[model samples]
Target: DLTPRQVTLRDRTTIATIVPFSSRYGVPPTLLQYLSDTMNKEIEGGDTYPMMDTMTTDAFATYWFQNFGAIMLLGTYASASAVTEGNDWATQCLGSFYIKPNYTGRSSHISNAGFLVTDSARNRGVGRLMGEAYLAWAPLLGYTYSVFNLVYETNVASCRIWDALGFKKIGRVPGCGNLKSYPDRLVDAIIYGRELGGPLDEQAGEERFDKIRFYLKYGTYPHGADRAEKSRLRSAATHYRLREDDVLMLKGREVVAEVERQWGIAREVHERGHGGINRTTTTIAEKFHWVRIKETVSDVIRNCKECKDKEAAKTAVVVPAKRKLDGAAEEYLAGSEAAPSPALRGEQEQMVGAEQNDEQFHVPASPPQADKTLTPHQMDGEPYYTSLEYSGQTPNAFQTEPHGDLAPVHLHADAALSLDPQIMGPMRDDFTLGYPQLHDSTGQPQFAEEAFHIGGHEVGRGRKWEG
Candidate 1:
């Protein structure tokens, strides 16, 4: 809980008292509901908060007061002890804020806070009073640093208050905030950070893990850094330990590559049969730590020329199915001068139905949602190849599921190396690059380039696309 402080109203003479309540004991239900409604109203105004949908009172309470309750500013000038709420929270409160750990475990010392001032309290300086009090109370609550991860650039007042209070702009992301006010345009978001009880490093340490490495090497804080700088570094070292004097490990997993490993890890996971988005993201997340990782994986899949070629291959294969249907209809009608009897028609339709259900022509059934997430490597299964070329000498045509189409799925270049010598011989002799007709490994009957093997599977991005 925060100490009672006097916050002057817009008139300057009218002083309002601010008080805080702890979440562990819980705020009153009615008051929490009132605050929820006020915050929901602010969300709808489309100026401050970015959340498009309003939350229920219970959800709002859990979000705001779940970790740390809230510091509430009273509207009346009457001393905090002299006042009591006879009506509702709306009439009694001017503003409120909650402070909680922004990141869990090792980074728990760094706190994040959300602020709200009722519409009636605008221009009354209640916000600044809360900010000043926050600077004092956050450290008291055990936070060493405060990070405002998504302070919208459009929120000029909030930016000014943070700037005036000596918080540094640690980072910025472009066009990341899909704000309601700017529905047609995405807005940039600023990452603001400050030491709770002292000044912040203007550079934000230049590198995230550098100080940890330095401290681990020397058994002390960085040279020439002040008390605040040393304190920040000390806090960051909590989750990390030197496993091999050079390698950093968190718990059991190696903490690697702040930015260097994102693309390579995303690509490696992606190139394993070009799995779906969920598979690609989950595999990397389990082993690596980095910012903007999900976005990176999304970019890899979205821009992959090989995957795009596979998409176009789907369209190419469907045309042959239509031709097969026309050819089948002509063959069924030939030699029959008159309409066949219903019994005969029924027998012919049954035969066609049996042919449709044959494994070679049967369309592939969708795997369960759970199975879709496991990449071929994770499942320890082989990549099945889709039929693009006919194997006249062996049983390599569409056998898995064929409805005028569908084959054994697809084989990656790595998997192709395991094929029979006879099959491999023909594949090698005819292999050429530049978007050749080959199946996708995603179990979908489609064409793909770059992942195909011509003579045999070669390492590194599978038969590299020559410029």
Candidate 2:
């Protein structure tokens, strides 16, 4: 296929390619004979093309029509005069190639293409230029991918050009063929492929302009408008005829943010002054279609700490008033007193009460006893276990020990098991083991001595003498 546009290389050389038409170019038979002869010479060399053998002019033409539906004639011109002169026009005939769906039928997305540059055009960047043109045309022809099937490893120039053009080497078949230039030595064949998305790029550009087209037709922004206004906008859009000059192209949000950073924020700071909100607002309004341009500029400058610091530096420094600070501290204290902490009702009050009295105490006592000195025998019960019984019980309920000599069960007063002991002053209440039966059975109080002592004096004993 022939491209409608021409490509100019980095060296300022313009190149173009087309399929030879006898009626159009008026080329003499001699030029066609020379092009066919030069192509066969390159194929016979065997360093680049995989022809395996050379062909005569008629055989090559027949092979070209059978393999490729089209052929490309690449021409390089140094000046416009050479093109119009039509003699010694410096042209190359790219060989026919077969590229199609793979055998599996799943890789129909990619089209395989192969070609060799003419021997006269070798080392002149003609291959690279042709490859670039092929890639550009492949996408336009509805092909999403293209692959070079057999790039010999010995051909370093071709490989370098492909690599520079962003083609990835997807595969390598080691020692695939013998090269004539390398004296019967075999070289690996490399496969290079590239994804084509040129058409989709054009589609994306069209979609970007769609938003601007909508705004131009209706003369109103698309978003943040009410239903009544939208109805009126639809009527306006129906009658409106947009001119080319009315196309106000707006960018996406990300591009807008970048523009604000570079132009709006950075420029104002570099210009050595806070140019006021109105100036910044007008500067942005002239260029962009922000949803709320004034608010957006105000927010960007207001939140910028650097801008604030610069503005502050230009003004006089004022010392903080001592009385104001003192008044603020007093206000905070009064507010804290007004709403007491929840902890003051329960845990905090208990902690405060404990601190006020010198008497020793324990808190959150473990299960079975708040009284630390009480033993299992004194409670008249067996030891408590959280797990299953040794007799294979499921631990659903308590079971007494099957012993005949077990002591009678005793029920202690709830007050005796309280975790917190009441405290009044510098002394505690006389705490006693209130087991009357144990006292009567032993003929003496079991806890005759005090559990606590202070200042080397028995305090809060079975009987109390002082507070």
Best by TM-score: 1
How many clashing pairs per prediction, in order?
A: 10, 0
lDDT at position 299, candidate 2 = 43
Worst 10 residues of 1 by lDDT: 370-379
lDDT of 1 by residue, 359-454 (tens): 443435333222111112111232322222222212222333333222322333343433444433443323332122323444343422454445
Tell how far residue 455 is off in model 1, in angstroms.
Answer: 83
Clashing pairs for predicted structure model 1, backbone only:
360-402, 361-402, 361-403, 362-401, 362-402, 384-410, 385-409, 385-410, 386-409, 428-455
- Report model 1's TM-score to 2 decimal places: 0.41
Q: Which ten-residue region of model 2 has the weakest summed lDDT?
A: 392-401
Error of 2 at 20 (Å): 8.4
Point out where model 2 deviates above 4 Å: 13-32, 65-109, 198-467
RMSD of each: 22.0, 23.4
